[model samples]
Target: MAKNHLLLSFSFFSVLIIAQISHIFAKNTSKSPIVIQPYIIDYRNGTVTKYYNGPASFVPPPIDSQVQSKDIVIPSPSYHNLRARVFLPARPDPSRKIPVLLYFHGGAFCIGSAFGWGDSHYVAKVAAEARVIAIAVDYRLYPDFTVPAPLEDAWAALEWVAAHASRAGPGHDPWVAQYGHLGRIFAGGDSSGATIAHNLAVRVGMGHGPHLSGLFLAMPYFLGSKRVPLEPKWFPFSPNYKVWPYVCNHCKGGVNNKFINPFGRGAPSIAHLGCKKLLVYTAEVDELRGRAIWYYKRVRTSRWPGQARWIEAKGQSHIFHISKPDDPATTKLIRDLSAFVNSN
Candidate 1:
């Protein structure tokens, strides 16, 4: 009886040890950071925190107020709030329909807010200058929600815009009803946002509707497992390298996933692009310049029945225009973009 008692005691002690070990293991694993730490690692620890301030709500002025802005709340199942800031030109003539620009901001897909001061101001300026109604999408970011989530939000925003294209009055966006030109919609973005725009174009090509007349990818971010010629030596080891898998939930195909790298081997051809025209902008000093040029070349030679054009900003870095809006190069960019949006 004593021996049996001893055995039970040993078993009980063993259980305690195992449980303690399990607890330690869980603690260590949980402590490892799961976020995009620049120049280091990008992992998902299932925690999400906003690093930027969300734009505050404000009452928009009338159409004649140079440019009007308003916040739109889009109901989402995955997110508590998915919103967009809509910018409308002042005094749009009701007799004429205005083009719509669905814009996404760039912050590596992990940062940035559509309502951010810079983004909001930029979109407003674009709307007033290009004479197009701009909808800057505020998508869910990493750690909280991963890849495909932002894309879903973007599509939802588009759908909502389409559904409310003609619905004006109480609770509806008046700018859209008053000035939105649904038939001349365009999708545009910068950096990772540009990547999302490309994916959206692809999905639209694959039969998703509300057809886009043009696609504008400014300082686009496109990548693959293989390094391109002239790629920065540090690129292969940079935190940007890990950004794709980290935000994409460590997708099975890695960088080859069509959504992450539109130029990947298995991705659908540029021929399948839904838009009739594509405008790609690149900065001379940007690391992603090579890939943008490569994309333009491929599209130009592809079977895609669309017109493609590329413009390179001399001695400029990625998204330089956004930061230095008063620069000559930025002015040129605005001019080029305005021409594209106003073109038939």
Candidate 2:
């Protein structure tokens, strides 16, 4: 009887241990970390990659008199259509064609839309104040669309805008009809959107010559590699952070070849960019600061007769200059960006 009782006690303890182990494993498996920092990849190989968290729908703020926002649709490659928000100045002089600023939102290629507060809201304000036509593009995101899908969408939108600009206005110069000068096309964005901006500029430059007059990137993540090459103060390892190959695989449900990875694809050649100017904004405390800085340096050192202006907030971090209007950094960013647009 004593032996049996001892055996029973041992068996109970063993079962408890097994149960605990199983529970732990189940918990981890269910909530696995999505953004794992790569261990071996050297981020210096010109890879600019990052990830974004899934987004929930957000209600926009109250509309004001400064800008008029309208939705427009464009055709997509997959027998579908994409949407965009056109922000036009309230008091427009029909006689003069305005320059179009093609803007993309930054949500790490996941949770952003063309009409988001960061991109659309700010661009509208800038357009109205600076008198530029702002077209905030809403490109398709990942998991539903794969790598280059977003890029393709961006290119298509550009072409669509260029093609339709003439018809968008009456008596307006066909080339400058919709948004002023076709040669004055300015592409810009923040975060992942910035990546797209740089990619589009590079591709256009590499091809027949860029239709873009300038490229503006704010805290741009132009790499597809894993590690961010910096010890960031924020949620660097959060599930929202991701790299290429891994992100592309996860996004498309399969691994894609490395040649198409923009950042890892190597530094873009400046000769193809022609004479377009570049405006790169960097946050002092952003995780991708190193990459942005690196890009700025490369562009500044390039052979192109373009200008590279770097605006680093003294005490601002990633997205810090975007949110909360009361913040001084945000105010500074607005001023700087507006000035850049006006000068360009």
By lDDT, who's the top model here? Answer: 1
Local error of candidate 2 at residue 79 (angstroms): 2.4
What's the lDDT of the predicted structure labeled candidate 1?
A: 0.78
Off-target runs (Cα >4 Å) in candidate 1 are 1-65, 76-79, 165-171
lDDT of each: 0.78, 0.65
lDDT of 2 at 74: 70
In TM-score terms, candidate 2 sits at 0.75
Supply candidate 2's per-residue lDDT for 218: 85
Question: Which candidate gets the maximum TM-score versus the true structure?
Answer: 1
Q: In candidate 2, which residue pairs clash?
A: 47-223, 48-222, 48-223, 48-224, 49-223, 49-224, 176-180
